[model samples]
Target: MPRQPLVRPGRKLGAVALDVSSSHRAWLDPTRETYLASGRTLGELGDRIPLAKSKLSELLRGVGLYPRWEVIHRLAAELDMPSWPLHRLWRQAALDAGKAPEWIDRSTRASAATARRRPPLDHDGLRQLVEHDYRFYAQVFLCDDERDIAVQDTFAALWLRWDTALCSPDIRAFAWSILRATVMARATYRDGRPELEAAVFDTVALQTQISPSAGAARMTRLVELFRAISRLPVTQLDTMVLLHLCGFTAERASGLLGVPLAAVRADERRAMRHLESAVTLKPDTEGPIT
Candidate 1:
């Protein structure tokens, strides 16, 4: 198959010619030359990077698509090029493609303004916040032997940076953001070590204390439900917990996760379906007879 040119030469969007950045083109030139000099075809490059041929072509031309950070990083590694230049070029391409959202700019400005006007949180208030949210934080970061350490580190970080978090107009949203960052950092640090990430569902199930008002059967079933929830992907599990357990609205979850509202809704739906299927398949040994 004939390889497509990176940018459609002389292509116009509507009546106006697409504005291509000279700097981005210049930055991409060395990488492009190296790939060709290596005698690798576009298809070969795509196969190596595991990107679609069409997508790879668009990326090479500095037009059409703005790939995610991982994709840019992969291409840079494959081409033996510096990742910083590739990141710059990809960001430029995204801007030229008009793919950058308006809200991103507005949000940046709003956050700056909020930071300027917000006051510091008092020590007592910070302590209260940590005490109230510790259980939820434990559940969020519950990985094998690291659970207690992760929770302690997260709270310590929160306490240290409570003033910065207080700068947000919504304190809860700010707290959630901090928690999400802490959990992600801990997860990434342990990414390749599966033993470290040991199945948390069983541990979480054991730690859950039943309420006195609940019957024994009801408590057993509740534990079973939590175990099932713990089996979900981290993103889906976090979304479900934030929405149902933490009593966050979809909008709040979206803000905390730094994802679109639609994505939060979709994750919630998928999580619920997964939990429903698990519950349906399990023997009803613990539930009370109707």
Candidate 2:
């Protein structure tokens, strides 16, 4: 009888499982040695980089760099410290000497083969974005340049393609921006429509939060919010997108942006203050501005 190949269990989604191959371990040793030359820990390297500790650890271990030495080497390389600074020197030399890294061409070819296998964005975060705010629809629209036709086309596509695997947290965050842009553009279009007076009604309709017949008064309040948003500067748009539309808490938004939580909170407050100053209540008995 012919010998049978063994099938290994897969790692949990959003995480890299350890590769127990001997060749993988061998490849990581040199990287480990490089770190020893630079003198830093993997945990220390993780602190300076964008990854969380567990993720950093996983990135190292999956490539057979775990067990300390390999971690340190990657840190040194990531930080451009000595020992593994050869990579940096090579980059600089390539620039100064009018050449490229020796592995660049080869690596690019190899990377292209594996690139398609990777997932797009984290799943859990994506679900949260959809669950929390209708504002996300606007953000996504904006990324595509706030064009109604484009936004609607994209939304129609995503709405049709919705699935559980598409709900990663990272993917959700990414989509949040796109949705915001898309909704904003749609809102802009609605503002100019003969039947609609404010972007809020458009935004609400974009999210499907209420029926089309939700009444002019409710839509007017939504319009008031949009007006306040419009008065804010473009520089603060990211904060507004994350805090208001995406419905990310201050802490989570801060973590996602790699800024201090206080900064996120302060920006949220500032955005709200600006909105409060901009809104004006119309009399209940009065008709909406046509």
Candidate 3:
């Protein structure tokens, strides 16, 4: 017996085929009408929207590709058009492709009200940005408590300096600069003193279960290593941690540290030498010096 095709030739299963080349033309009609009513050329529209001219052409021609949610939102904001229509189209496109929509759930009405009330730097936007970057900043500081305090303080400072930050070409970079500076300043203040008062290993018992004797010895060595790292000069330690541990490039480390590239490299070399000389491992001894 011959099995029939689920979709017969020349007959779409639905009102329109979900394919980009076919369904996109109809789906994009509303947006296209809105674009035309605005009395702007494709290039002019592209200038305002985040999409490129070529991409815009493809979109208008009913290409199946969907723009990111942020791009869609930006388009709606710039076009002075309601966002729901575009969002619906995007959702449908995703469904047609058998994939989940990459939309971040947020209240559209609330967002519109926010725009009407003030500029984009409201409490919600700030909170979202901070939450997204919290882990990155935490890793850089290597202390959750200090990172939290620093993030809060940095946001406070940024709010006060919002006007200046808004004028920058890259707002994210500007915000990061302020946050990094605050975190580094806090770190600098705690330098030359005992930052870690006690052993900071996580769950000795868990490690002991894996290898009882070796686990205890490794824990002691780790504590001593951390103590040694704490005793290093602020510059060397900051450079070493940012470049080596945090996986930042030399250029990025230099920018964050407000030092020259040569200085960062020099500090890294000095830091390695200092650590090797400070922490000695005796062949007969089982662990590092405490």
Candidate 4:
């Protein structure tokens, strides 16, 4: 009946709004659906969990500090749903919510000290999948040893939570989330958004030898596209990077991203739509987005 400590080490009463990421919403949405399906009143569930109704409301709504995995485990058992998937989803959301790595380690099979010892199955395959995607994307922002450390840290985090990765409803999405978090943590940002200026010069830049007037015009268009692309959600941004900048075919991108073919196309469409609306390059709406 007593609310577990409302504040924990590294999590204060009024931290910034990190819980609004799509990853966090996906993490909590299933539990909400299952709880609703069970048709149980908040009072009833609260009583079973032995937490105050007010505290229960916050957890269900994903308000305040991130919910402890212990509480989520209890809630899942009480609801008669498997907790493993939720456990994986919860940690994805936690990373997005700015939970410290040490804190995340506590909710897993081992503490940070021993977490890296237990690598999950298909270690090589998973590592290659993640490493390839990371290197290509991270090259946009990181270089040399920086990129290597970023990749190393990503795999280390994966090793720590490989069980959860395996149990997730979508292992690909879960692993991708970890990679995104790792790279974004160290990426350069402009005005609080990812600074993707490095990418502007990657695939589609102006001719090296052009008249000053024409070059200036082309450079302006590139900057416009750059700003728009930089502001995209990471989901669409990843797709754009692969399909446009890296020149991967959509099928190849689907394979590389470990998402459905439809998902890859949908991301491409959404990103292109945003680009078209945001930039009037060459005064041609029919021009290529890439």
Best by TM-score: 4
- In candidate 2 the C-alpha lDDT for residue 86 amounts to 27
- Runs in model 2 with CA error above 4 Å? 1-212, 281-290
lDDT of the candidates, in the order given: 0.52, 0.43, 0.52, 0.65
Which regions of candidate 3 deviate over 4 angstroms?
A: 1-146, 161-214, 281-290
Error of model 4, residue 213, in angstroms: 13
Give the distance in Å from residue 230's predicted Cα in candidate 4 to where it truly belongs: 1.1
Looking at model 3, residue 105 earns an lDDT score of 36
Per-model RMSD to reference: 17.0, 17.4, 20.9, 9.9
Model 2 per-residue lDDT tens digits across residues 1-290: 21222332333223234543322322233333333344455455667754566766565455333232333344544744332222322233233333454434343343222212212243334434443344343443343343433333333323322332144344444454444433443454334421122333344333445466768776667666555565565425556656555446667666554456777677767766776567764553112211
Candidate 2 local lDDT, residue 143:
36
lDDT of 3 at 262: 96
**lDDT for each residue of candidate 4 in 1-290, tens digit (9 for 90 to 100):** 21122222322223224545655655465566556555566677779877877787777777777777767777777876545445655676687678987888776643221222334458657776557766876766666565675666566555545555666767777777777776776678888887766665544322232234556557667667777888898779888877766666889777656789999999999998988788776643123354
Question: What would the per-residue lDDT of candidate 1 be over residues 1-290, giving only the tens digit for each residue?
Answer: 22223433232213111454543443355455545544556676679878887677776666663445566556667765544434444444445456565632442343221122222346346546454444454454455444554444444444434544555565555566555544554453323321212222333322343233656665556555656766778778777666655556788667666577998899888888887778653344222111
Kindly list the per-residue Cα lDDT of model 3 for residues 1-290, writing each as its tens digit. 21222322231212222454322332355455445445566566678775677677666655545545565566667666545444544444445555553343332332442232232446348557454344453444446675675666455445534545566664555666666556665553345453442323322222233243455665566556556766778677666555544456788766654567899888888877887787664442222221
Report clashes for each candidate as comma-separated counts. Answer: 1, 31, 0, 1
Question: What is the TM-score of candidate 3?
Answer: 0.38
